[model samples]
Target: MSTPVPLPITWSPRRNRLVLLPLSAAMVVLFTVMAFVLPANWHLNDRVAMVVSGLLFAGVGLMLARPRVTADEEGVTVVNFVRTRRLAWAEVVRVNLRAGDPWVILDLADGTALAAVGIQPAGGRVQAIQAARTLRDLVDERAVPQDGSTTAQG
Candidate 1:
């Protein structure tokens, strides 16, 4: 029998900030221009502060919008707001998605739990559940069994 080939799967938050990020950047530019042109009875320092604050807001928007999780035959890559983690299938012990959880959690063989923030419940309960199930299945298909048998061999 021929074994089925595993395809790469990528999961990201449903509500992407692609639009928000660009919109925010435009707002920052608008604010910068307004800070210099608009007559609001404000001093130079106040205008400078407003421009800086707008830039900060745009930075925050960019941070919130850039998380993703990708998995393939070799391993999984998780890119969070501030950190990125890559783990081989053998390192993952199990996938955990429970009620009231904000995101999918990965239990690793090293006794550390990694949060898959990209697969969040905020997307929708049904969608989140389906993603968790799919990720679990992929992990199972790639992970080595306790009996020393590899899933790919089957």
Candidate 2:
């Protein structure tokens, strides 16, 4: 029989964010230029405010595009726009993929749910579902057996 294919140790969105980084940078530049070139019947504070707002917008864009999920032998790490969380493989009780959901949600043993922003439905439903399945498989492979033995195969 053929050997089993190796499962991925990590999972992330199939879509690349490289494009967003540059696009957001361009927007910031455009806004900065407009702040100086666009004539507005307003005070200096208003101009500064406009520029700062533009920068904040760009920052948000960059932050949203930087989300990622990484898994290893020990646990998984999820990096969202505002926060990063790490959960051991044992802590993940279930993986949920629902229709109309933007991303995969992980149900933890602690009665909390964690959104896997890295596995976004925006990458296409098929891809997102496959990613969720892969994550589930990883969790199963790392699960602890009833006898307190580890199930990790690699």
Candidate 3:
């Protein structure tokens, strides 16, 4: 039988929109200042600067509008505005969704853990717990730990 895919239950940034809003606003302010503060005599340079900065700002807005997520036969891929990562199903060792700060913890063979942020459900505690458990089971079933172990037999 074919193995099931490890899909991404949720995909988002560790820092929320509220957290990035301020920084984005600050960039706008800085860009605006640079664009307008320059002397009018330096017309060409100022115009170019303004256009570039505006394009950058627009790009940021677009990224915010569409946070990225890709899940397939292998595993989940989450793209935060700054970085993107593809996690393979076998590499994901565990998913820990705890109270107060629910997260998917990926345990690696090298004793490393990667916390997948932004997969939390909107429901109350019970729902979160259930989701966490489900993720855990999925990862557990697929992953093969080290110690020269093999999960499948011919």
Give the winner by TM-score: 1
lDDT tens string, model 3, 9-76?
A: 55444344555566667777777777777777878777677858866885686466344444555675
Q: Specify the highest-lDDT model's number.
A: 1
Which residue runs of candidate 2 sit more than 4 Å off their true CA positions?
1-10, 14-19, 40-43, 152-154
Per-model TM-score versus the true fold: 0.83, 0.81, 0.53
* Candidate 2 lDDT tens digits, 24-94: 78878887887787676767887777788788888887887877778777788988778999898888988
The residue-by-residue lDDT of candidate 1 on 1-154, one tens digit each, is 3344356778888566656678788879987987898686889898998799889888877888878889987899998988999999889889989999999999998899999898988877898898888888777777888787755554
Ranking by TM-score: 1, 2, 3
Residue-pair clash count for candidate 1: 0
Per-candidate RMSD, Å: 3.0, 3.0, 6.3
Residue pairs in clash, model 1: none
lDDT of model 2 at position 135: 79
lDDT of each: 0.83, 0.78, 0.61
How far off is residue 12 in model 3, in Å?
5.1
